[model samples]
Target: MLLPKQMTRVLIVGSRNALKDTIEVLYQLEAAHLIDFSAEEEGFSLGAPLPESSVASQRLLKLRSLEKDMGIDDEDVSGQMETGQIEMDLASTIDGLEAEITGAIESKNKINLRINELEADKAVLQSFQALPLDLELYHDYDSLKVFTGKVRGDPSALVKAAAPQSEVFLSGNGDFAAVFVNTAQADEAQKALVQVGYTEVPAPAGPGSPQKHVAKIDEELEALRSSMKEAVDKLDELKDKHSTFVKAADEHLSIIVEKAETPLRIGTTEYTFAMDAWVPTSEMPKVEKAIAEKLGNRAHLESLEVMSRMEPHGHDEEGEEHAPAKVEEIPVKLENGKTAKKFEFMSGMLSTPKYREIDPTSAMMITLPIFFGLMVGDIGYGIPFMLLGLIGLKKCVSDEWKTISTLLFFGGIWATVFGVFLFGEAYGIHFAEQAHDLSWSSLLGVQLPHELVLGGFEIPLGIYSKLHSVKQILYMSVWIGIAHLFIGFCIGFYNKSIRYGMKHAIIEKISWLMILVGGALLLLFVVDFMILGKDVALTDIRMLVAAVLLVIGIGMAYKGEGSGAILELPGLMGNIISYTRLAAIGMSKAGLALAFNTIAFEVMWGHDFHVLGSNSGDIVMLIAALGIFLVGHLTIFILAIISAGLHSLRLHYVEFFMKFYEGGGVEFKPLKVIRKYTIEKNGVSE
Candidate 1:
């Protein structure tokens, strides 16, 4: 389809008591894209969550916390248990599981805390152990001043000279020192200690010898570590036992909570609730039938309006007049077949197509990969790309990977086709033979034909070489760009005509179309007269027509868009020139291939200046040539994906799409459930 699917506004009203049943039917139908409730509705309020939600929610929260504490993951679990089994076990098991998990975690925390304390105490004791003193002697000294810390050098002689009545102790390592001096001479002792570059560490308060204290703390740490290990093992056991059940029960309870809370988005009164939504026009009949059969008199559905592509009309009226209709943002639901759906995300990256306009995914899918192929143009790389894409499609699940795979698969097909017919090349070499260059015919030691005679006509395999046909390829790309933009402007004209009016559409888009056509004609004339070196007169028919068209087109554009149109004239010229990159990239890759081939075969072999020249006869030289050939080609292959892939995408996003696309419409998001770990069983479809 050219545009998104049409939508119809629906109002579903039901008694407050029947809200639950009505919600169940809607989920089962899976058609509505519900609008949120607003306070503007008189006598209506937002509905509260059901009573069952509270208990289930609380239990689910605790279960998640337990899952985290035990390091339980969905991947770690292996089997699915029955829903009945889960429901039966959840109530009784949750409370006991919570108690067990909480106790295990608390014990682990306590052990960790004690281990940290013991480790700190052991560190302090180790420093004191060097002094050969009891911990009590370092702290309990009223008539003495004790200086205990690590020192740069032993200061026994210095301390003795400063305080005559001082006692000094030195560690066997001589890094720890303790000086005790009479209270009257403490100031002198401190000054003497400062000369030895001492930094004080306060003596730890304890009653035992330092060596015994260290031993005691080490014993306690070992016991705490053992307890910590036991706690970890217990947590692991619980995870192994319950990860599957926990994930499944979480899915089950989550579905219940979500359905119960549906009324939160619907307006509610004391007696009834109102639900506003959009459903595809085609599905409206099915929805209506389901509601009538399931809900009966408990609910009422009113089809308010069937939306159209044309914008709504409103204007000022007399005395008893109505307010102008506001332009509602219709959500876009693209209609695409399986093949086209793969390209949807690429277009969606810019924004969803507006409901009233064309869905551009089809156009993008056709052109994007072709541009990629044109830039690459080689069967050697194309086959690998196709293989990569096929593998990715099979193994990868994400939308991004799948889209990339789609590009590679489609692009590879076009690349191979162009390589065989248009360029007759693989890995930048012509399939047959070319003057002063290598070819597969020479490499394989066989003759290859340049053309095949079919039904009395000669068909050339190689039409135009990428590096040798720069001007022709560049000219063709420019014309291709012009044709693509012409299509863009036409689509834009149609969109604008429906959205506003024909007059506005013609002035905005048709005017630009006229300018583009005139410029294209002028380019043809210029190429013929200048590049072809053909004589041409100023009064030539093509020149006269181009001048007139350009003047009229610019006049119309300036009238519609003011002076901004004039400023954009140069930009239009630049957009056309941008297409030259298609040929430029191909030429660059060909040049690289030629250089690698020369280095590996011609220069190294030094026998003939040809790409297919035999490698050096020496065994070591042959191996070196083969290594260079592999590594050099490998670099080009990897680079081809990046440069070719990104540049082709850029041409679409920046140049082609800018011609008409003004995306940013809201995407249609229907109320639905996506199941992962749990599946409905026993013929239940919910």
Candidate 2:
């Protein structure tokens, strides 16, 4: 069905004791999409989580913390364990894992802290190593004030002049200087040091030379680094040993927790509980039977209403958009097969189709690639595209790559077909001979036929050339746009008819269809008069038909949509013209290909372009030609993916889809547990 899957509202009510069995049954069925309960009804309150929730949640928190410490991740998990095994070993495993992880992580943190301190100490010691001073000598001077620092130049002479009684010790390199000045002249000594660009360095209270202190720190740093590695290795060992069990236990507990928490979405009275859900309409009988067989007399299943696509009219008397706020929207699950499923992302990216409307994914799938192939109608790039798409489909797992790969694979098929039959060229050169033209036949010094002769029948190898057939291709593209938009209006009419009524549908959509048809006819008359130099009078039959249709369509649109309809006439004309880009982009790509081919073969390799004169070729010319050819086509190939592919998608998004698609619908999400590492052999898949 092109429509979304049908849904039915269901009410499941039972005594409090049956809640657990009912939840288990629902999980096993995997058919219910539960709606969270609101405490609106009197005497009905939101239910609490089951008794087991607290224990499971606490364990889950601890496991997650351990997971972070051990760097355990989804990718690291390699194997699975049975639920029974996880249940048996979970308690002991968590206890032991906690101790090992806590010890290793604590040790690793301490080593890391010590390493940082040692590194800081080493940086300080490096500065003082230049000066030949013991650490204790620079500090604790009572009779004399000492200034020890680095200076831009030798400050010994400056210090001697500033304080006559001062003794200065300059390093051999002369960049480091230490001055001892008497108390009375300390202020004068400091001023002299500042004039020489001296920056102060404070001395530490250690009892040895800076070199010995740095060596001692280095030994400690090396020891800490070794310990850090050992700590990391211990954590890694723990991760490897417990990886499978932890993953399995997490999955197992998650399933338990999810089941326990189901009650939180149910409304409960003093003695009874009620749960609301949406079940697939087709599965109602099976669900009913399952509930009867499993819960028996303890619980009862009540079928509410079976949902339909015929929603009520738009706005009510109050002019509010949505009049029925209390009505629950039936979730939309698009019933697409495997091929159409691939295009769902492209369509869904815009909006999920409403249950009442048609799913547009199938439509997008048909045209998106066709538009792409039409733009990249060349054999040279098409074959490689197919190969790339195939490789990507096999190798890539993401939704994005799969969609792109689908486009390339299907678009390549049409590209190959069009390149062979329509363009009859590869890399912008013709396969056969033409007057005053370079072709494969001319370049290789062999004869090539213009058409295939099979059973005395002739089939042309080429139809309309992209570069030479501008008028024809442009005219064709405009009509393609018209046909595409015509389909859009038809879909709009159907959607409006279903949603509003036939009268509103006719007024809104069919009027636009009439205008579009009139414009198409008027275009034919205008093209003949202006471009073909033919006599096309206002009284001509085509002109009369166009005028009559346009007037009636305009009147209808004005009555239905007011002055906006009058304004949209020129907009419609522009919309039709927008499709000319399809032909324009193709011509641009062909121009690029021709330019590259000329530069590589005619200029670089000195091969005859046939329109020009012939020339001789050599080994060096052949290599250069190959290089230019490879480089030039590679650029074109990448541009084709971006240009041809994107323009096609844009044409659909901006021009085609806007005509009919109004998306925004709730997607169907069913209630089910997904197990990653644990398998339940006893469970059955719905």
Candidate 3:
């Protein structure tokens, strides 16, 4: 599908008493994209949220807080809980959980704080353990100053010299010392201690042997740790028991709050309410029937005009105060099929397509992988890539990974095809024997053919080599760029034609098409005259046609878009030249592969082993060569994903999409609930 699904404007008006029922019906249908009501409208004001919103929101908040306190993750949820069961137990369970979880968490925090305190005390006491002293003897001397800490060398002599009455005790290792001096001589003793690189370690407040105090602290620490383990286990048990109910109740309450808040987006009076929305044109009949059959005379649905691509100019000829269509606000619902839908994420990475324009996901689905495959053309790498991609697709649940896997799978398919037919190589080596380089045929002493004859039809296996056919590859890349851009211009032309009109489309888009065509023709002419050395006259038919097309196209483009058109001429040339990366990247990979193959094969066969079956290589050296080959190609394979993948995406995003896409439309999002943990039946979830 090229364009977004058609959306029709709709107005649903209902009695105030039926507002909740109407909201329920619309959500069940899941067909409406509601428009926010403006309070500036005459006699219509924004409605307040319904009665259920406040209570449900409060419960949801508390549940989330409990989940956070328990460190609950989605993986902790083991099974689903019925909505009816959750409703029955929600109030009591929340209260119980709040108390139990709070007590456990608080106990854990207290134990951790105490453990830290004990550890700090033990660290200080260990320093004193090396000294032969009781803890109380170092402090509480009225006329003496005590200095206890570590020192680089013995400070006993210096302290005794500075203060004659001072007593200095050094540990057996001479790393710890305590100095006691008369208060008058404390300054002198401190200076002597500083000279020996002293750093203070204040004795912790206590009594008794330092060893005894340390032993007591360690014992206390063990008890606290055991208590901590119990607290953690209790919290874990609570999490295991209630994780399912917490998650399901969260979902159930969230749905209620969302539905209850619907009135805030609508307009209401004391007796009635009105809501504006957009519905797909195909679903209008179903929606109208549902509202009539369910809500009866209490509610009514009105079908407004179907939105069109044409921009609003002025009132129509017979207009009688009709409102102009809000084209910008018409949400775009892309119409891609299942196969093309995988690329919707890639297109959405840019922006949603406007309702007026084509959805480019389908187009990108075709070309992006082709470009990637062309850049990474190697069967050896392609097969592994396909396998990795397939595994990722099967296992990955995220959109980002799924999209990447899709690219790798599809791109690998094309890479295999190109490697087999276009390049006829695997890991940069030809299947057939090469005149100058090594090949599988040369290495294995077997002859491989360049073509396969099937049912009397000749199918060439090997065509152009990446390293040897630079000119031809480059030429082909340029033409590929031209054709890709040609498709872009065609899409652009159609987009403009629908959005504005045919004349505007011609001036805006078809003019660029002409310029592109003229440039392509000129490229052919230049190739013939200069590279092929063909003598061409100044008034040759190709040259004349090219000149006429360029002039007329430029004139029209300038008239439509002014001086910008002239500025973009050189840019268009740059865009075309950019595609040459398709060839350049492949050649770079080929060159790297060649270097690696040469080194590896050289290690195995020696320097002069160029001819096929000329030498018998050593098994050890051959094994080593295989190791190098494996590591080298693995590196190239990783680089290929980055370089080739990014370049291909860039070519589309920058060059191809720039030709046509103007993507800033809002995505269509209907009011719907996505249930994962619970199932709904019998008017209640199970």
Model 1 regions lying over 4 Å from their true place: 81-84, 191-197, 205-209, 313-327, 452-459, 501-503, 611-617, 681-686
lDDT of 2 by residue, 331-360 (tens): 888999898898888888788998778888
Whole-model alpha-carbon lDDT for candidate 1? 0.84
Count of steric clashes across candidates, in order: 0, 0, 0
Clashing residue pairs in candidate 1 (N, C-alpha, C atoms within 3 angstroms): none
| Candidate lDDT (C-alpha), each | 0.84, 0.84, 0.89
User: Per-residue CA lDDT of candidate 1, range 506-609, in tens?
Assistant: 88889999999999989989998999988998888888889988999999988887788899899989988988888888889889987887787753567564
Tell me the lDDT of model 2 at 677.
98
lDDT of 3 by residue, 71-169 (tens): 778898877767677777888988888899889999999999999999998988988998889999988989999999999999988888988889998
Candidate 3 lDDT at 334 equals: 91
* Candidate 3 accuracy as lDDT: 0.89
User: How many Å off is the CA of 420 in candidate 1?
Assistant: 2.3
Global CA lDDT of candidate 2, please? 0.84
* Range of the 10 consecutive residues with the lowest summed lDDT in candidate 1: 314-323
Q: TM-scores for all candidates?
A: 0.92, 0.93, 0.93
